[model samples]
Target: MATSKPQVSPELSKHYSARMVAVFRYGSLAIAGIGFIQAVIFAALGSWVVVAMELSAFVGGLAIYFLIRRGHLAFGILAGQAALMAIAITMGLILDVPTADAPRISHLYLLVLAALGYLNYQRGKSRAQLVLIGLCLLAFIVLASAPLTSPFVVLPDMARTIGTWANAVMATTLLAVCIHAMQAEFNRKDKFSRDLMTALWNDEFQLAYQPQVDLSQNTIGAEALLRWNSPKRGAVSPVEFIPQAEELGLMVAIGGWVLEQGCRTLAEWSKNPLFRHLSLSINVSASQLMHRDFEAFVRDTLVKTRANPHRLILELTESVLVTDIDLVIAKLDGLRELGITIALDDFGTGYSSLSYLRRLPIQQVKIDRSFVQDAVNSSVSASLVKNVVLMSRDLGHTVLAEGVETIEQHALLARFGCIEFQGYFYGKPMALADFEQRIEARIKRLA
Candidate 1:
């Protein structure tokens, strides 16, 4: 499945950009070393100034390495490189340095300096770095054109000087091309991610209602679970994408859609008397609950869908209760006052499971699949399940064991007085039509 575009925070984006710049800085330094070697060989059998300049560039690169290793700002390293280039320009002006036949050599140095300055500008927050980059560019321009205008006999021939100018222009063009390409690729990936998310939001996803049964009544009470029916990838599980959606701040919208869809399904089911009494539960994530208007959202959805609030159960994980216990209690109490039932989902999975049960005004505890899966074989898991079910019962909360696939597991749970059960043994998650039919068949059998 095509992944949704991740919504990275500004601080995180800057951190990622800094890391990328660090890698690029090292790569550029290596390339600069190669260029310096060529410059040294070309100017050999001649001036000592070329050797000194090459040594200066090497030393400057070492300083940049230490700065990066020490966790200093990457832009600071680029700024230091610009300063070294300025020093080189000053030395060339004072010494009247000899330039080899390769005029491109001088232009290459100017281009590298300009690139470092521009990158520093990109990574900088304050205007100082930008201003520094502008100064560096201006200096490079003067240094590059000096051979053409001055009595400094660096490049004595006009052809050599013209070649130098051409090389500088070419290098500048290449840098621009690289910048443009990076920006284009970033934009393209960003747009693709946005489009993928939009599609997911626009009902490209499907909903599956898993039957949560009341073991006492042998009747199915459905819980609406989200299933993404991607056009390209078939079915995408909520376990995979919901966390990403929450991180991107898209969970509220997606949760709203699920609420509406679930209520609508309940209203439709209510038409059949046999299915009318089946309570439909929907899982609400912590992010959805954190919204200030969440209580109103739920109330409004019930009113709009004409579904009975009492029959609409909102399943919340224990993690939500622990994060902000007072807030959760306040919100849940308000929900209960509205006659909306709340179920504490995946009950024993959290850190402070027992403490949360006492604090939150919850009506039911859906024992997590982990304990239920192991209850048939493992004594430890069975003991844990028995304790949870007994505690919940003593506390006057309904306990439901999930993932009961075997008759033995079902019989074991029944022995422990777990009044509610749900899993593949009763029935796999089915479409709305199939579920209604199953409800009818089960009702007839009971009758």
Candidate 2:
């Protein structure tokens, strides 16, 4: 038995780009080190001032790279690195190239600076970067004028060329760098998607169970929530990747995994007499349920797990049933015949028609959290919850108020004839190990 329920992880963006930025900086640091070492080897040929500037850049780049690797000051470091590259290139423009070089060093450096800026432009410094790039381009024109455009920036005897060729080379280099950056981004995303495809059977996914309690504050059932923790991507929300899975034709496989895992949990929990009669509910996607073999799969899962069919519930959103009502109805009927409970989850937020209630074999309707959350403060919301409860009773279906977080909210819903309740108030979703202990403890207490 466990002592505490599983704590909810913090809400975070699944598609965070910080990892990629860190990886990019890791490469940049190596390049900066190489540049500094090259400068040292050729110190005798170039201006000492140029070597000194490269020294500072290399040292600063090293510091920034380590800071970003530690995940410290990420946004600031990304923006600063972009600005630093632009500045270093601009300043390096005034330096004498140690070896034979193109005469349009200033123009080339400016375009390179612009490309760096554009690559890191969307890293939270949009407008400032635009100004920086614009200034760099404008400086090219400013430097072309009389005093700024001296033929010999250094020695009087040094020959120079500022023809159509220099401009074309600069333009071509900038375009190629931009194209390369875009292609790199595309490749990064492609690799992430492919990794997720391979991750399905790699034990990267799992389920969390949130208890559903009745009016007496005793646990009777739970909703099994799907969660994934990717090795490369960190924690991923079903909200973020489930749609992607549907598009990639991975949902059927993922959904099957959920069903099997949920059944396995039930089989394990069946050891405790308290959990023997408890219902386990799992969400099914429209496509998952629409599959011809879905019923057979469910039946086989229950038989294999030795879980009673009466204690298994399959939840589907009301909107899912609207498009192919006839086909869905036929499929759902077969599920009900197996003594599996069917529920309408997130009930009121969708197009909830009495027609669905009358025609479908739904055993319960979960009142969407919106109305339950507002029921305490809003009279209209309270009335709506009451109406839903009464309607469900009239139609021989039970009502479960979801997201009931406060005593006042719970009291109001309990008065409205809601038979079962679920939310943060009763218990958060917990791991199977912790939830099993919770069930044992609660049953003992009630006894």
Which pairs clash (backbone N, Cα, C closer than 3 Å) in model 2? none
Q: How far does residue 367 in candidate 1 sit from its true spot (Å)? A: 0.5
Indicate which candidate wins on lDDT: 2
lDDT of 2 by residue, 1-447 (tens): 001122222111222354446444654575367448645743655546546655765766677666655545334344544555554454435542222343434444455556655655533345766877787666655544423222233421232233224434644655575567657766765785686687796989878888888878888888888777898788866655675676677888888988888788778668866678788888888878877788899889888988778888888987676678888888899999989898898888777788888888899898988888888889998888899899999999988888888998888887888879988988887787788788788768778
Q: lDDT per prediction? A: 0.67, 0.68
Q: What lDDT tens digits, residue by residue, belong to model 1 across residues 237-263?
A: 454456556656778888888899988
Give me candidate 1's TM-score against the actual structure.
Answer: 0.58
Query: Each candidate's TM vs. the true structure?
Result: 0.58, 0.61
